[model samples]
Target chain A: MAVLQILEYPDPILKQLSKEVTNFNSSLETFLKDFIETLNSHKYCVGLAAPQTGNLQRIIGIDISRARKPHLNNGLLILINPKILEVSDFKIVREGCLSIPDFTANVKRAMHIVVAYQNAKGEAKILSTKDFEAHAIQHEIDHLDGVLFLDKISNPASDLFRRVRY
Target chain B: MNESKNYFAVFVLGTDSPGIVADISKALFELGANINDSSHTIIGNQFAMLLLISTEPVYNTETIQNAFQIVTQKRGLTVYTHQLRHEDVYRKSSEPGQLCVIHLYGADKPGIVYQVTSLLAKNSVNITDLSTRRFGSESKPIYIMYLEAEVPNNIDTRKLGSDLNKLALSLNVEIKYELEEVASL
Candidate 1:
């Protein structure tokens, strides 16, 4: 397993839509291991997407259990070509990203979501999540679509805040 | 000239009028003064502005003040300029804490701001930004206050909420507090 460098904002790769992960083989497994390793390298980072590491594939890693308040999390999650089937219970919450450091903004997201994805073994899996887990999943999915939290801010003047260094 | 000693805080206040920003900005631009940060807003019939500016050491507070003399005379504006201390040139970074917003509204009354802010200050809660607005008719005005603060993690927000509830009841107002959840991804 290797920890890959996370691409920061203004990187053209981050703005490109990730392609679907069609070949689920040893290469995919190796990439997944590196993805998990990269995520674990950061403190309090709950989720990550393939595009964040310059990989143009629809792969995301999420483990909200690492979050400060892991409300309704299901340990580690590896999703390939993930899609949101249903969503409800919308709420506005502040969000920050590794790609865009030192800034946080309020973004509206679904509190509950039903999603379908493929596992590392190429088997199809579906899950319904709520609260923090759901929020993390949604954020990672946005990365696959070349979207960032800054694009989702409702009011730039008031909702955006400068994050304090830890 | 000491390039490091060229920072100043400028304040401008005047009746609301067109071209105020354009005129002021043009004057500063001609003087090669860079506006590092500025906030301008209209309150009722008055336009208020606060600016942090930096220029070449050759330009002092008096130099910048003289540049605005034309606008001051033409627009009848009040202007103040003060050289900033080295320490004051940069804002202190905020401490790591949970960000929260407190919203309060009720019939207009005296001591509302004093009472609420005093309680917050006593509890060690740092107020980051706050604004109050008066609405409705003059005979029956309503006061609404929105405040953003950094709350220490050690403090129980539920307890703070309860205390605010009690304060609201005593003051005949409504108070709501919510933590600004920051999702890390």
Candidate 2:
């Protein structure tokens, strides 16, 4: 297994929409191995997407167990063509992308989610998660649509908590 | 040849009007000045603008002020220009620190700003941006303040939180602060 180079911001490839993975073959397995290797190579990185590595495919690798703080998570997951079936609850989380290294923004995301995806063998599967794992999933899925965390930022003080004039 | 002294701080103040920005920018454009940083705001019907601009070394504050004379006279505006020092040309990059935002609101009272800011100063927390607004009826005025500060690595944040909690109790205000954490995805 080899670690692939992660692309940074201003790379036009990151903004392009990723294509869906139709064939789950030997090449898909090889890419998943490198993808997991790349995710593990970075310290404290819990999630990674295909577009981040210049691959325009609907693939994501996540393991919230690697987070510094103890959080409820499934050990390791390789999700292909993941789609959010349901999203519930809301939370404001500050996130920094590996691509956009310089800034972090407060983004509101779902606290719980139900997702449908396919495993490497092309078998259909579904995962329901909440809290940190759910947050990581939403962030990775956004990459499939060429959506960056910067697009969903809310002003820390004034945007969500504006006071009503009496 | 004297490229070292090409920066100037320009300020414009006048009654609010639709074309104030257009006229000011037009004057600067005609003078071939590059606007590096600028902020324009409307405060109680007055238009206030602050700009940091760079131009050819031959142009100075006097020349810039003279260039705005026509616009100033026609628009009933006042313009002030000061040549910036060589050291002030570039802004200092922010130090690596934890980004935190503090929001507080309470019944209008004196010393709220002073008390909060002094505490931050003593702790070496550098404030990046701060805004305060007053609301409510005359008899029961409400004051709200939001400030974004950077906490250096050396500072103990838990202790600071407790200290802020104590201050909140004494001041009878609701103080809430959140340290923004960047989760790598």
Candidate 3:
């Protein structure tokens, strides 16, 4: 398994809408291996979308357990062709992206969400998540639709803060 | 004079009115200047703006000042320009640190800014941006301060919080702060 390069913003590919995953073939298996490796390579990185790695496929890897502070999560999640079935109330949370790397914005996201997705084996699964995990899920799902947190900021001048890289 | 662009720090202030930004930007654009960073806000009917502009090596601070002469005369705005050294352009810290946002509000009084900033300075906390406003009834004014700062890795955050609490008590103000966590997704 190898760590794939995360494409930063201004790269036209990052804005391209990711395609749905249809075939769970050997190539998909190989890509998943590299994707998981890349996700686990960074410290405190909880989630990564397929488009971030320049793969225009509807897939994301999330593991809030890897964060510095303890957060209630589903341990490690590899979601493919993920779809948000339902959502709850909105809350503001400061979010930063690996691709953007320069600024963090207070993005309004659903506090609770119901998601339907497929696993590595192409088996359908539904996950009901809340809090930080739900926020991560929404962020990753947006990547599949070519939407970045910058687009969802409540107030551009006030809510956006310069990111101090750690 | 060699080949690199010249950077200038430009400050503009005047009575708040429409067309301030349009006139200023048009001047800069005609001068072939690129605004690298800028922020403008209205404070109590006064329009204040700060801009970091870069021009070709041929232009200098004087050139920028001369370009704004029309706007200054027409709108009665005060404009100042100072050239900046190249080394100061990109001074990002090599070592990363924790980012913190501090919010403080209380009755209007002097020394509020001094007391809090002094405490932050003693702790090696670098203030990145700060804005303070006075509001509420004229008889009972309320002062609010919002600050964004970078805390060095060497500092103890827990102790800092307690210190701030003590300062809040002494100053008789409500102070709340949170360390910004960037969920790297």
Residue A79 accuracy (lDDT) in model 3: 96
| lDDT tens per residue, model 3, A65-137 | 9876688999999999999999998987778888988888888889899999999999999999998899999
lDDT of 1 by residue, B1-185 (tens): 23465898999999999999999999999999898778888999999998989998887888999999999999999999999977677545555567788999999899999999998887789887899999999999999999988887778888888888899999999999888557789
Cα lDDT tens digits for candidate 3, B20-71? 9999999999999999878899988999999988899888878889999999
The runs of at least 3 residues in candidate 1 whose Cα sits more than 4 Å from the true structure, single-residue gaps closed, are B1-9, B31-36, B52-60, B81-94
- Model 1 chain B scores worst on lDDT over the 10 consecutive residues at B88-97
Question: Where in model 2 is the C-alpha error above 4 Å?
Answer: A1-3, A8-10, A40-45, A63-72, A121-123, A153-166, B1-12, B31-38, B50-73, B76-95
Better of 2 and 3 by lDDT: 3
What DockQ class does candidate 2 belong to? acceptable
- Chain B TM-scores of the candidates: 0.91, 0.88, 0.93
Per-prediction DockQ comes to 0.54, 0.31, 0.55
CAPRI rating of model 1: medium
Query: Better model by DockQ, 1 or 2?
Result: 1
Give lDDT tens digits, candidate 1, residues A12-47: 898889999889888988888899999999988999
Question: Residue-wise lDDT of candidate 2 within B46-132, one digit each (tens)?
Answer: 999999898988998899999899999999999999999876765444454666789999998999989999998898998877889
Model 2 residue B78 distance off true place after TM-score fit, in angstroms: 5.0
- lDDT scores of the candidates, listed in order: 0.88, 0.85, 0.89
Best by TM-score: 3
TM for candidate 3 is 0.90
Which candidate has the highest lDDT of all? 3
